[model samples]
Target: MSEYIPLKYYFDRDLALHLADLIQSEYPRFTITSFVESVSTGVENKELKARVEVIANTLKQHLPTDYEEALAILLKILGPENKTEEGMFTNGYFLMPVAYFVERYGLDHFDLSLHAMYEITKRHTSEYAIRPYLIANSDRCMTYFQNWIKDPNSHVRRLVSEGTRPRLPWAKKIPPLKNDVQNNLSLLEKLMCDSSRYVQKSVANHINDLTKDNPEAVLTWIQKHISDNHGTNPKIIKHGLRTLIKSKDEHALELSRQVEQGV
Candidate 1:
């Protein structure tokens, strides 16, 4: 069990319940079931996403500054069952509260909430909702990324990339990281060969995002990093080279052609 922290002790339970009720009333169709069904189908609109943001903000007001309690609440709402097929839409609805608390409070603890949040969002199949919190704490976000890279869980490993994606859909871009792409790229390097396909996708997306501003840097890294002994980790390969392929860069094009030939 995780340690206890009085982080959310100051929050008003009534307010938290009120907010959850309001979300249900406002978006009657926004149940855990519906959310799970829609995860792969794509988000309905910004309005709904915004509503989630509203709930998150409300939760923020209630979150205790301590790390453990914050994570306890997040996990409580977004627990293991939500990640299963039986709990499809369950995960999406709970994300609002978890996101709310993380963004509102500071990330000052042993970074416990950071890890738990990453685990919760990892299965969501979309990172847009979590980007706000990630960007808001970008100054300290690197540490979260560094620690997650070596996590035993594949979901946590991918959070390192997905959470920091520059142009993640539904998310506003964070300019400083975009300007100095290396910081993000360097982090992705740790998970380039992650065992999980989900993680590889994130790594590729991170690389793709960097390719727009620094194609040469990405190309050099891929050449130096990709391995022959890794077998067929196409998800990682595709994500790692996504930007180059999209831009029709010379090397990227050649690799695509090779992939097609091999197929």
Candidate 2:
């Protein structure tokens, strides 16, 4: 077999060098030597997210302390928006730490960080980074989400759903989001018929997340959204109710059967 590489290896020394060079290109005064040195120390041993955290933390130390100034520098480094939906991890791998940097430090500045997410998510993903916005200001965050659902960029539209997942993997749970089921469903209603499969998956996953504790509410939603003109709605319900189906839930199985029949 060809030599195997670990997933964590993506955040390796070469990645650090590449990331440092990219930032240095945008902000000439960025100290490349110091940034890379700090990021490379024992980074290989840490797990995936830890590596991202280490780099993000190091960036905070090396860059200006003021959040907006540091964000300005970070923004300059995001070269262009990723037009395709599929290549976020491949084309935008370098931005993992950059997005994390925003998640870790940008929570305090609502509008600034929210705007930063809009810009960065188009290139990479602000999925995990954007959660704090929901936590810190649910109403304000919802206002932003309202606009994001209609956003022309697929990634921005995905963020409106993916970013608000109740128990989004690799990120901490947002209790408010988990508890506020109706508001969450309202947002999902808009995205259920999204053109992008990328957005569709997030919308489905968001609904699936709701089924964990709010199964009845999700069932109610399925009752309302599903019909003969199913479109992708049945698949959305089937995936969302998969957990319940395996447990032999009567209604969930019925819905799965409906999906199979394309009704």
Candidate 3:
């Protein structure tokens, strides 16, 4: 059997050259060699986040200095290709650096940054990048999420739940969502019955994250929705409560019907 490489290796010099080629193809003036040069140094030694920062910093040097213009140029280079299948990660893996760029440079321009994120999400995912906006501008970011819940792209819709998770793995926590359970539930309510399983899985994971801080709240929610509208809600609830069910939380197991005993 062959050993698998860690995900961080994807950001090494090969990826830098690949991205540079993609960008230079669209914009002839792009300095591909310079971009690769800046990204290649010290990148192999860094971990995942440090590698992302290295590429983002290198991008800043080669792309337009103006954030909006730089974002536009990157989008143009990314083009309109999207994943044809649900739950596929390989389709846009190359665009992770673009998300890092948005995270690093897009804070000051919320609207433009959000628009860029929406576009980038169609190609890859801005889930990791969007968390900072949620932290920096909770009200505005929440509003954007409410609207994005209806976005046609499954990735964009998935971002609404995945990006707002209080303890999303490999990403920073959003204190507002962590501190206010109701606010998190509000968004979940809108997505509980999402048409796409891709989106539904993210919603399930978001609720599961909530369980860590407030198990009772999640239990109550599961009980209320367990039998609603032909049992779809129960499936989602069960997935969300997997941790609680495994830990033998009396109410959670009972509500999920994993046990016959009453709480």
Candidate 4:
């Protein structure tokens, strides 16, 4: 097996150069060298997320001091729709910093930040960034997500569920959702039969995360949904109950029909 190299390494000087070239092309005043110098120094020691934060903070120093103005500059320079073939950490990875930019600077600008996130999500996920918003502005952010459930773009729809997971991986936990699992489940219900596998997968992962803290609630929720939509809900139930089934929880195993009678 190959030695494991942490993902943070990919955000190297080369990526900074690529980003600098893109920025300089759009805004003549952009000092590409300065941006590179700031990002490259001692960046290798940080992990993936820390490195991303370093880049975003460095960008804040170089771009407009006003958050909205800086965000506008980014929107103008963002590349075309991310090609499916490009891995998340490859081309278009610059959006990671953009997402962080929103997380760090756009909190107070609620509507504007969501609009930016909606646009950025189509290119690279704003899933990580959206969490803080959801935490800080629960009602408003939840309402935004409710509307996003019907977005024409699957990525936008996926964010509705992915961003609200009580325990989304690689991201902070949403305390409100953790304390009140029903709040999170309500949103998942809205997306139970999402057309896109991309969206459904997120919905399933969200439900599975719920299973950890509230197995009975999740199991009951899965059973109810499965009974209502036997065709599609089964796949989601299977995924949602994956952990419970693995632990041989009788209700979960029986509901999944992975075992008969007592066996």
Candidate 5:
């Protein structure tokens, strides 16, 4: 049997070499040797995320000074979009460095960056990349979220919720998203009964985060979602309330029990 390889190695020498080949295919001027040397050197010691940052920063150094030009070239190398919701990190691993490139540098160009994220997410994900936009420009980013919540792509719709979670793992907290509790839950309301399990799980997780800071509000909103008879999935409520129930909140416990009993 082939030995097991850790997921971090996905960003290792082979990926760097592969990325160099793709970039050269699109941009003849790309310095293949330097990019691979820079990306692979000392990368063995770094963990997954650090390796991703190394590649993203390396791309910045090797790509053109003009961000859009560089981004356009990177877009060409995206190859094919993953057709299913599964194994994004595996099937579309190559997009990670590209997404990080946009997340790190695409801030100043809102429309361009948003469009890029829309495209990249269809294959992998822009969940982490989209957070910076919320931090830098919540009002406008929220507008994009509003539109994206209804996007036909499940991955795109999932980004709207996951990107705004109050306590998304490995992502910095957005004070605006945390403080704007009512508006945040309202944004998630549209996705409450979404048909896509991927999108629904993201919605539940986002609500789970809201529960930490605004228990009363979250519980109340969930109660409304339940009582409204809108055909919202019971799991969104049950999983969303897990943290609360674990904390032994009376309201959360009772409500969760009720949902389990189909009340």
Candidate 6:
């Protein structure tokens, strides 16, 4: 009957109902009764870690076969928050589904997960899960990215930067980006001026991650786009300059000073 119990105990009918009630309280507008029931029936209630893994695997299995339906269920279950009432939900609950969607439909059915990703990422922006969805199907994702960069929805464009992050959480590390990271900066080349604060943050993080392997490239980006994005946005300035500051690079320091002086 705990507020924050592990997934391993979901099999106990009493425990499942209690946990479901707590989650329902958190998200009164949306209900996850079916998923909770499915979890309760599954043997995942034995070992916590194993149970979570099983759920992740199950979601993965479902993605390729019946993605539209599966994604619908996932998005509905995740629900909205106060500030934004969309498919925003807890990161932990969506991890398995995200991972599964990436593995199953990332190649042939990018659209199947793309819409759902746009929704779930509003709340659970796990870098780990987003990375594979981008890398495994970079070409396909890029096709969508081409269309999304200009779409009215900032959430879609945010995925452009977020999905390609090198050190994204729970995802495998892409060494190519990590090594000559600057090469990958083109992914967000057009997103620098995205109107959404959330989308802009993802753009900044993309630049921040690149700085580790390519300081010069990041510097060039900042300098070239300085007039365009430097002074106006805090996220761009901060994330773009993170590496230079961390390395104590001289030019970066000068730029920081300039931004400060402008302020």
Among the numbered candidates, top TM-score falls to 5
**Model 3, span 30-148: residue lDDT tens:** 89878887888859688988998899889888887888888887888776647653423465777888988999899999999998888888888888999888878888988888789
lDDT of each: 0.56, 0.84, 0.80, 0.80, 0.87, 0.59
What is the per-residue lDDT of model 4 for residues 182-261, given as tens digits with 9 covering 90 to 100? 88888888788777777778888988888888898877876676666534456776787788889999998888883222
Cα displacement (angstroms), candidate 1, residue 125, comes to: 7.9
Over 57-96, each residue of candidate 1 has an lDDT whose tens digit, in order, gives 5444344444565456555544352333222233354455
Q: lDDT by residue for model 2 over 10-73, one digit each (tens)?
A: 8877888887887787778888888888888958579999999998998898888999998998
Worst 10 residues of 2 by lDDT: 226-235
Q: Report the C-alpha lDDT of model 5 over 172-199, residue by residue, as the tens digit.
A: 8765373679988888899988999998
**Could you tell which candidate, 1 or 6, scores higher by lDDT?**
6
Candidate 5 to native Cα RMSD, angstroms:
1.6
Query: What is the alpha-carbon lDDT for the whole of candidate 1?
Result: 0.56
* Reference-based lDDT, residue 34, model 3: 80
Query: What TM-score fits each model?
Result: 0.63, 0.92, 0.90, 0.90, 0.95, 0.65
**Candidate 2 or 1, higher TM-score:** 2
RMSD of 2: 2.0
The candidate that achieves the highest lDDT relative to the unseen native structure: 5
Candidate 5 is scored at a TM of 0.95
Task: Name the lDDT of candidate 6.
Answer: 0.59
Ranking by lDDT: 5, 2, 3, 4, 6, 1
Native-referenced Cα lDDT, model 3: 0.80
Q: Which scores higher on lDDT, 1 or 2? A: 2
The TM-score, computed over Cα atoms with residue i paired to residue i, of candidate 3 is: 0.90
- The better candidate by lDDT, 3 or 6, is 3
Reference-based lDDT, residue 16, model 2: 80
